[model samples]
Target chain A: SYYEKVGFRGVEEKKSLEILLKENPLDLEKLSTFSQRFPLPSMYRIHVWKVLLGILPPHSDSHALVGGYRKEQYNDILEALHVMRYVNCSTPFTDVCLRMFQLESQVLPRCSETTGPDEENEDFLSIARSMEEIVDDPIDCYWLIKCFVHQFHAKFGDSIPHLPKSLEHYLSQEEPRLLRHLKNTDALAQLPYGLWFRRCFAGCLPESSLCRVWDKVISGSCKVLVFVALEILLSYNNVLLGISRPEGVAKLLCNIPQENTDAIVTKAIDSWHKYCGTPMHAV
Target chain B: FLEDVKCQAKAELQSSDGRYQAQRRITQLLQTELLQLYSRVETEAPAGTASGSPPGGRADSYP
Candidate 1:
């Protein structure tokens, strides 16, 4: 909790965001680049995320209009769910209807007793549970994650093709010997990249660090994510080199130091620039 | 006014598309890099650098 408070930017950072918010036509490119470089204060994150996620339009003037519509839509969806609660779950068509509603609204569908939890449902639940820890309102959390998933699903969807391989590639670039060690010992396959990439390191990294990492993801490319994962592995380079078992390597990666939020992000950014040949925001 | 909103939405979509394209391009590059490294590793004999030595059990003090 203290870490979260400390994670908030200084007065100058807050003032900078406020100034950008006041601009008549928000410069999203500048806003994105700024957000990528600095940790967004808790107060400004929602607005910045909303605009970037396109939940609120880019233009400041249209916020109220679009906000009103989105609120009405959410309320309507809520009302429908309330009515749906009274319906019989045994009806075959009800399941189909619920699925369609989830597809349309992007809201986490109320879990039914009859149906098994699918991967999509589990993913949404994981994200909702994670956001609930950080954000207060269930509604706001729902919309934020919904918009986020919609925006970056291709890059981070359930099956992110070549994610672990790409991580290995970056690792090799940094520490070829470390990568070799991991491969020789068959520890590379033990890495929880599904949790790392698909969940955006939600459970792997500390929540404060996770939020900052997500901020970069929202503002920049998913390429930054690979570097972040690489940074985590490299932090344990020496330790991993000594360990021989795959389970030991995976366990070490699962829990990492929380205080290095700034260092990890800074190093990740440097690594991104080194490999990508451009700053994350530039892409 | 409605057209302006539509245009804004289009621009946002285009920006998002650009990010996705960039992500894909980077993925392809990384794949190529991995392939090159694979070939290099194959050509060079195993260095036997990684040892199965006992760990010191230190987690926090990273180098």
Candidate 2:
């Protein structure tokens, strides 16, 4: 009950967002403050994310081009998953961001091609180049895709040998009591991050909070995911550490209270900013 | 988009073209909890590794 964090109300948030949007290139510095608020307005969330992710075109594509890219997105995922399946496995959960992030990175030109943003912007240029390097290497491209899929199954697969590797990534820094609970077999099944990246919170958080997380991620980099996950755990740290069994710990993480969306997100944004001062440059 | 997925799922159910048979078959096989797909191909391959190795070889072997 004490965990909630205050966020901006309607008029204040709308005014902030409108100012950020008015600039021809989209005012990114203003965006940082706007995003930190958490639980952003619901209706404009998708449009806001498209801007941050560089999916929307500055000049609208012909309806056909928009339609074509959506089709291409689907085909690319099925194609990539086709590659994964041949390897004889499948991700435990569907990755909603995979095609949009992966396929877009591989096939679509970065903001330079997609949004036609300022060619001189260092962030856009860096994002574009990193994407190109991954796409250009066919071997590395598939390897990345395979890891995305295996991240879910490989960590949570029923086999004893395939214990949760992702848990070790961050849990090593957690309180020992929490770390012990996380290592339990059942708790690992409902791992907070799982394998899907943004999809991990798919049906979990408030729509507004969820979109804000995406905004931070697309505008910055993949480094935001781990920081955000850690923030969530910190909120329930003492309560979670007290729990004895795996199922109990999992139940707490799986059903995080909606009211704390504001707090969880605020902390996550701050930590993401602090830990990832320079974006890691990978998707 | 959901509608498109529903239609495709229906088509796959109604004996649609096997154009994506490999994709479909692999999804089906995964339900059996086979740890690795290509390994089965190797074991069952009448022609041995040369013929049995998957189109991409072992999925885990990817760099």
Cα-based lDDT for every prediction? 0.67, 0.48
**Which pairs clash inside model 1?**
none
Q: Model 1: per-residue lDDT, tens digit, A1-283? A: 8766754546667888888888766778878877776778888887898887767766786677666555555554444444444234453332333342363544433343355677765565555556656776544565677677666685455447677878988787789999999999999988877667777776666676677778877875777778888998888899999999999988888777677766887788777777776544431
Clashes of each: 0, 1
Q: Candidate 1 at residue A228, lDDT?
A: 89
- What CAPRI-style quality would you assign to candidate 2? incorrect
lDDT (10s digit) by residue, model 1, range B2-31: 876787777556544544443443344334
Give fnat of each prediction, in order.
0.09, 0.00
Q: Write the per-residue lDDT of candidate 2 for residues B1-63, one digit (tens) a residue.
A: 576556434533332222234344434434332344455565577454467335334455443
* Model 1 Cα shift for residue A157 (angstroms): 5.4
Model 2: lDDT of residue B37: 45
DockQ (C-alpha based) per candidate is 0.04, 0.03
